[model samples]
Target: MTRAVAVELRGVSCEYRTRTGRVLAVEKLSMQASDREFVALLGPSGCGKSTLLKMVAGLVPATAGEVLVYGRPVVRPLESLGMVFQSPVLLRWRTVINNVLFPAEATGRRDAAMRERAMALLRLVGLTGFEDKYPHELSGGMAQRVSLARALLLEPTLLLMDEPFGALDALTREEMGIELLRIWQEQPKTILFVTHSISESVLLADRVIVMTPRPGRVAAEITIDLPRPRSGRMRVLPRFGELVSVLQDEMGIAT
Candidate 1:
């Protein structure tokens, strides 16, 4: 059976009014993520990759065209979606479990069942014993794990992650990618991830959507035919290198 479309952008454009006149961030860009798909948006800085993600979440208005989620037009902030930014953005004062419970508290669903679910999520992200730790006490990877758990707390159908692992050291970044895949497989939600790293995109995405420089649009879309349950060992495989090379070429690299 064909998978349902979870997120879509139809000829979407986003323009900002600035002192320097109108600045176009995204121009007539279109793309779709099917149900439970892991789609990565790959582009350089200022390419509007993050802008497109915001449009899907209804955080940013589209200048033209339509943004849709689960077949509904996105005119306001979507309730059934979660977002993870580059920074973990955890509240400094809240403990890890409280941070995970924050969304439920905001939505007035902070009950016994929700608290139980929050603990379960912390366990899912491998943070079983760190629930009471403050944000400053946790290392960068641990903190991002808390953020990931928090985002998944409500069990949103679609997850928008804007370069979520971009700030970590190289080794930690690779670990997070594998951990994310594990969580995704167990939880099974549609994910739209934004990243500037070619290898990271190739390792994490089912289909990599390459965006053009400024005023972003689709430059290419490449499907990663690698096997599921991906691990770091796969990175050394010839096929993995080939896919990374293709994405590099799409970004104007000659190798």
Candidate 2:
């Protein structure tokens, strides 16, 4: 079965003008993600991984070349995509359910059905009773779960996640990865995830796009052949270590 392409970047480059001069963050980088595929942008800091996500979301304009989503050119911010950043970025005053429904409310789509969907999403992320709580009342992991739920409120077909678990402790980070996979299985979406962890890239992604530093480009594209519905037990597998080692070498890490 041939899967449809969800995102395609043709010779895409992104540049920014600093006070010093022009800084090329990404240069002639091209990549694509298939429909409902989980693709991770795996690279070190300053590699423009997050920049690529912004271009796909139309938050940043490509300095050269084209970005296409679902076979259409992306000229403006896409309405059919959801984004979750490093921080949960929840409104302090608003309760969990309100934060989740904020998108629908802002777009004038908020109503009974939308509210019901928000509750269901909260439940999906295992935050059923915490809907009435404020951001300050929740722990780091719980806050991120709420962020995940909010991102899924409208059920967008594409999800752009920028190290959503990067801020948590090691144990919590591991827990969230498992939780994310569970949620994804239940509600599948084409996910373009950005991360710097080699093990995380191997664990969460169907394919890892290892990138060069600074003026980012694809260093390598590695397909993860691990069986799906992945668990922590798989992390101890020899194949898993091999895949992680491959990513490390691509990043020039002495592993």
Off by over 4 Å in 2: none
Model 1: per-residue lDDT, tens digit, 91-199? Answer: 9999999999999999999999999999999998889989889999999999999999999998999999999999999999999999999999998999999999999
List candidate 1 stretches off by more than 4 Å.
none
What TM-score do all the candidates reach, one by one? 0.98, 0.98
Give the Å shift of residue 157 in candidate 2.
0.7
Separately for all candidates shown, the number of backbone clashes (residues 3 or more apart, or on different chains) is: 0, 0
lDDT for each candidate structure: 0.95, 0.93
Report each candidate's C-alpha RMSD, comma-separated, in the order given. 0.8, 0.8
Residue-by-residue lDDT tens digits, candidate 2, 102-195? 9999999999999999999988888999889999999999999999988898889999999999999988988889888998898889999999
- Candidate 1, position 59, lDDT: 90
